[model samples]
Target: MAALAATDSADLEKLLLEVCSSPSWAADVAASRPWSDRGALLAANAAAMARLTTADLADAMAGHARIGSPKAGDATSEREQAGIQGVDRALLDELHGANAAYEAKFGHVFLICATGRTAATMLAALRERFPNDPATEAEIVRGELRKINDIRLGRLLDEPS
Candidate 1:
């Protein structure tokens, strides 16, 4: 916590941006630094995420690849969504179609914290959320984004140990 709190501004922003890709979110989290512990830092991240405007949320969502592709997204996404790869072909195809419908409806990728979730479970979730209203779906996306951030932040802070 001390090391992250004491990091230089440029480095900190870069790191935070890698986690969520929203400039404002990163900036806000960075601004709220000097956290006393991991819990405090995580709280700052959640608060910053909550403060995001719709546009900012979209900007962060842009950083993620569409779910269920043959490939996972960026390196971090690759690790977080590792379970989606090498699944049954039928399942993968279904996910691809669901992703298309989701993007067509929401104008953004279907964001989920894929860590620890099996492909079937994620696919089921995607199907379930397909009928959600925009406002509700946005809330779901925000929650998923928060989960991903929490995991990534843990990784970021754990690096030195």
Candidate 2:
């Protein structure tokens, strides 16, 4: 927290963007800096996230890789989607099909905080959310994004020893 609170504006913005792809969100969070603890930083994150417009949320969601197809070299995505790493090929194909259906329905990748969740669990969520109307799904996406952002922020402030 102290390190981030003391980082320069540009550096801070860059770091926050890694946590959330939305420029407005990063700026909003960076502006509320000098946080004294994790709770304060997360509160700031939640507030900024709540203020995001539809377009802003879209921009934020753009940062995440689709669940089954983690980007080749993105450590963040790889780590967060670790549950799918060594799963069977049949399950992977099923995940791919489910991802396509979800995307077609929502017009965006299914977003979930996959850090500690299994691939099967994520697949089930995609199926569950597939039936939701766009507005409700958008809110759910926002909530998932909020969880992801909170985890990323904690990672940013609390480096491993």
Best by TM-score: 2
Lowest summed lDDT over 10 consecutive residues: which window, candidate 1?
65-74
lDDT of 2 by residue, 82-111 (tens): 999889999999999999988887888999
**What lDDT score belongs to each candidate, Candidate 1 first?**
0.88, 0.91
Off by over 4 Å in 1: 70-73
Error of 2 at 79 (Å): 0.2
Report the lDDT tens digits of candidate 1 across residue range 60-144. 9988877765243357767777888689999988888998998899888998998888889989999999999999999999989
TM-score against truth, every candidate: 0.95, 0.97
Query: Best-fitting candidate, measured by lDDT?
Result: 2
Per-residue lDDT, model 1, residue 116, is 89
